[model samples]
Target: MTLEAYNLLGWKSETVNLSFPDEDSWRLDAILYEVDSQKSFYWLLFTGGSISIYLLIYFIQKDSLLKAIRKSRLLFTILFPILLIYIDVNRIEELIHLSL
Candidate 1:
């Protein structure tokens, strides 16, 4: 579905399917925000944490992800959630992460 969406939009995308380490933030986020994955992945890009990963997004409606970026465009909105995200795509293990 994601690949098809990108193809239709004339965009090139390669997805990585790595387990999000031992973090718990994103999971709780999914429940908290009631996000619909059909359109977004709840981007959570924090900039610090060394041993764990966390996720955070505040949307549920389809296409709300794009809408958020359109309005904010802050570093916090894009690849920062999984858009699923956190800060510094390079050092994903360096931020305030949530875990169970």
Candidate 2:
């Protein structure tokens, strides 16, 4: 169950309350919002939470579970945080260099 599936099933919970046109946009919005902050700890917490959900799904599915989680952790720790920091830093630099 995704948000769309939840909506279809008429599960009007808090998570379902914040519906976007699509998943990609919702994720992008989440990242953008989080990346603007000074606290990378919040970013790590958010990323960890999302990964935990995916890890749960991986465990439930049960086909090569260990491999799936290893891959997920590798990408999550190595790529995700790097990309987030790179984008956030660039954005901050742009704002700092902006001329009035």
Candidate 3:
């Protein structure tokens, strides 16, 4: 699925295998390089905006920071699964549209 997505996005990706000097387990890393710079720039901008908002909220609600943090965590726990489902559904919709 990941490879398919990378191919769809016209990105260059490679899988690398690494072994630790002392450990027996080997690790496989999928490196995706040569990504679209415009997408990367937009993602960085969105992440920065999210962090700025979080910091602003933390500072403004300093006295209730802990409470706010707890609430945020709870909200994330509740929303994350739904968000994942929505993303997956959107992906499937896109795939179906492409196939048709």
Candidate 4:
């Protein structure tokens, strides 16, 4: 179950009274807010960088659009799995261990 689903179930349950200490509650909220804001900022930065690079490539290779697209596709295909593996290496290792 997802965090939201779990939270909803907890809310519906009569025994679940989720309350943190006052100082810790504010600190947790602040940390969550900071994490959210940082994620948004990083996402925006990545999007802007991608667009800028695409535009630059488009401008530089105006006549070779097909070649540029092919190169981009190849690059993405090669990098995508590497990125996925990099991000999920821990999960992948856990699964391998479980299987063994």
Number of the top TM-score candidate: 4
Backbone clash count, each prediction separately: 20, 0, 0, 0
Candidate 4 per-residue lDDT over residues 1-100, each given as its tens digit: 0112124255633322234455545544543454455455556546655765676587557657666656455455445544543444444334333333
TM-score versus the correct structure, for each prediction: 0.20, 0.34, 0.29, 0.38
TM-score for candidate 2, please give it.
0.34
lDDT of 3 by residue, 1-100 (tens): 2323444366856533333333312211112222233345446545655665576587657647666656445445435544554554465445434433
Per-residue alpha-carbon lDDT of candidate 2 for residues 7-99, written as tens digits (9 for 90 to 100): 436686533223334534644455445445636744775677587667757765765767666655645664666676667766644533331
| Weakest 10 consecutive residues of candidate 2 by summed lDDT | 1-10
Using TM-score as the measure, name the better of candidate 1 and candidate 3: 3
Select the stronger candidate by lDDT from 3 and 4: 4
TM-score-best of 2 and 3: 2
lDDT of each: 0.35, 0.54, 0.45, 0.48
lDDT of 2 at 57: 73
Q: Any idea what lDDT model 2 has?
A: 0.54
Residue 21's lDDT in candidate 3: 36
Lowest lDDT block of 10, candidate 3: 24-33
lDDT tens digits, residue span 1-100, model 1: 0111135376856542333344654644443343233224422233321112222133223346666444444444444454443222222322222221
